[model samples]
Target chain A: MSELVPNKSIYEFYRLVEEHHILLAFQGMMTTDILTMMGKNLKEQAEDHIFHRRIFSVMVELVQNINLHSADKAYSESDKKMVGKGIIVLSTSADGKIFTVASGNLIRKSEIESLRQKIDHINRLSEEQLRDYYLEQLRAPEDQDSSGLIGVARRAKNPLAYDFIHVDEEHAFFLLTVPIHQQNSDK
Target chain B: MENFSIKGSNYIPTVHFDAKSGVLEISGESYHEYTVEFFQPIIQWLREYLATPGREIVFNFKMVYFNTSTSRRFLEIFDMLEDYQRSKKGKVTINWYYQNNDFDMLESGQDFAEDVNLPFNFYTF
Candidate 1:
């Protein structure tokens, strides 16, 4: 809607989000780089036992999201963190109740609807159903192996909620708001 | 006392464990494809070391960053060290070091200390 030029406004807004709320922000040129920045961020999140298992599984989902949806035409999901190409943010909400992680990159207008449908479908399943499906996928071999969004759904199961913001249909930003597991809140 | 090294990929960290020096370091950037596969050998080594007995093992993690999969392996390694320390076969001293302002790394070391009941001297420069 605004100037195509990199908005100082966008960077400033990103700064505001990171300074005030983020537990971690995988900002500045994070496209489909599974090896570098985003992977680093996921690894940090998975440092804990809970994350080592559940959250990591969810991260697989996010990775898939990058793999499948990243609009960049030149790179695969498992490549470099292209400048001005990808943005992934991992953070927690103010109440400490939600850990929100999201990513964005260029994509085609035609593909957006299908991806939206996929995310919506994944989000609708019950916990039991989701778990069973996760197991099914787990047993199955890696067909696509992007960020395991389905895996994230069942494994990480956003504690708060998962949201998304579309920078137009051509570029959509996905936000996953997961709550801190209340059961393991002591740590 | 076997020497092993695994290359680090964009998605995983390389693990080089040296039994001769009794110096086992999980250093460098660690973001692995599969947590289980990458860490399985390190876990196996620690277990085998515990059984065989040897000099006190030293752990140095000058890691820039590690993913969740590697963290699990780190935990397992810490557990093995604790077991070694308690058995008294050899001493295990962990110098968990980090840069001056790497809060995540510092806190992570603290978290490990709490979990393993090991006295992790958290140092930052």
Candidate 2:
């Protein structure tokens, strides 16, 4: 049993995390309870209330995006329900000036085009335009799903970065990165 | 209808909608996952309350944090109030409370105010 695991790989994983300035990382079932717990812990790591609120709001939106749309699913006995599986990584720039919330989850390959178009459309908007777009979508209809991404972009005040890596004929690994600058606290 | 009240958690807000006083208040942090589903009954209660001809309504939104998903529902409530006021059935007032330094929250209030025709009072604690 001892031979099944390698010490060198474990040490390397630790080094990788340290090098990335990762504050928190979790990969597993995405449930509301899990979100609440993670949010509480993450809030504890920041002293500035306004900054943490921004991070916390972004984290909630990103986690819900996974919970609502991830193609990967698993049954959790503790939760007594089926839940989405995804990864969330919170890291800071080396200078500690910007915090990045990175997330990944499995998504249907069919969704790639639509997702790309939605994100690209958001990335092209100016700040004022983004706000107007958000309000416009919010007023469109309750079923519209585009407002979440708009809200995220508006709050982050930065273009979202994304990548879709094909994993199989039917599924792809979707990665989204949103950077929150600490200076935005003044805004 | 009797007074509607639900205790808040770390993720859900405390909702107190008084049918008698016509003062509906939602306070605390709200980041619930099933946002639409969670707010349905509350919205229904409002619908029922607004059924009568004349009833003064004071809606207080004392939220510290709510996700973007919740924003749509908030807008729905504002729209309902706007409609109610426009119909000349009752007087409506909205008091939006935010923390002193939470400008994002304040801006959200301002945005909602600008979107609707109802009176909105902004307060900071």
Candidate 3:
């Protein structure tokens, strides 16, 4: 058996996360129940009502992407469902002026190109254009494969940052980061 | 038609549609595991209601949050209402209620308002 030893690298990573004021970080099977519990906890922890709702909405959408689309899955006996395996980190900027939700999961390499194109298209649209796109999609035929990426774009109202890192010939790790500005105290 | 009402759960919103009064209200949060399954009945009810064509139909939305799938169903409801209005079946009004200072909710209502021809009355509680 290999001896378990504390690594200095882990200490450095912990320091980095602490310095960023990360609110929540989890790496495991993500189920709807867990998402709901996390959302409830976040709602209680967040002081600003509007920002709290924004954070909750963004978190739900991001986690759902993993739950529905991630190629990596874990069976949960409690929920009697296949849960997505992924890592998610919710953090505030060092200045506490903005919040960022980041999630990573394995995805089929074949799906990357279309996903990338969709994100790129959303990034190019103006707010007005985005609203139009949202409505158009809302009226479109229901596709279970659809991840409602437009809702994420609409809530964040910022260009989504993403990367696909090659894992194998058939799969890759998809990482997505969404940034939301904290509402001004006066507003 | 009999009145329809469903209590809200952690993942489903409360629905109250008074057949006698012609007022339909949905409130609380909705992120159901099976979005279609949760909304199918309500959609069917609304369809039947529109067939009768009341004098005035008022739909109220007081949602705290809803997933994108639920939003799509909501759009369907709006389309049905729009059809009813266009056919001169009734005077349709949408009342969207939100907490004060919740701009996200307010803006969401505005977004829906823009998509439909009917005006949405915004109320803050």
Q: Give the DockQ (2 decimals) of all models.
A: 0.06, 0.78, 0.50
Model 1 misplacement above 4 A: A1-187, B7-11
Q: Work out the TM-score per prediction.
A: 0.48, 0.94, 0.89
Cα distance off (Å), candidate 2, residue A55: 0.6
Q: Count the backbone clashes (under 3 Å) in each candidate.
A: 24, 0, 0
Worst 10 residues of 2 chain B by lDDT: B45-54
What is the RMSD, in Å, between candidate 1 and the native fold over all Cα?
10.2
| Ranked candidates, highest lDDT first | 2, 3, 1
- Please give me the DockQ of candidate 2 compared with the native complex: 0.78
Highest-DockQ candidate: 2
Clashing pairs in 3: none
- What TM-score would chain A of each candidate receive against the reference chain A? 0.60, 0.91, 0.87
Instruction: Identify the leading candidate in terms of TM-score.
Output: 2
Best lDDT among the predictions, by candidate number: 2
State the weakest 10-residue window (summed lDDT) of model 1 chain B: B64-73
> Can you write out model 1's per-residue Cα lDDT over A1-187, one digit (the tens) per residue?
7757578878987789767686555533333354355455655655454343334444444554454455654433444323244555556666655555555556666755666676677778886666455434443444342125554554454432544565774655554455445334233
Model 2 misplacement above 4 A: A1-5, A76-81, A140-144
Per-residue lDDT of model 3, residues A1-187, tens digit only? 9766679878988898888798888888877777778888887887887777777787887787887788999898766778788988899887888889999999999999998988899899998888888888887777643437777777887788999999999999999999988753224
Candidate 2 lDDT by residue in tens digits, B1-125: 88999999988999999888889999999988777888998899888888885789999999999988889899999998888888858899999999998988998898899888999999997
By TM-score, the better pick of 2 and 3 is 2
True-contact fraction in model 2 equals 0.72
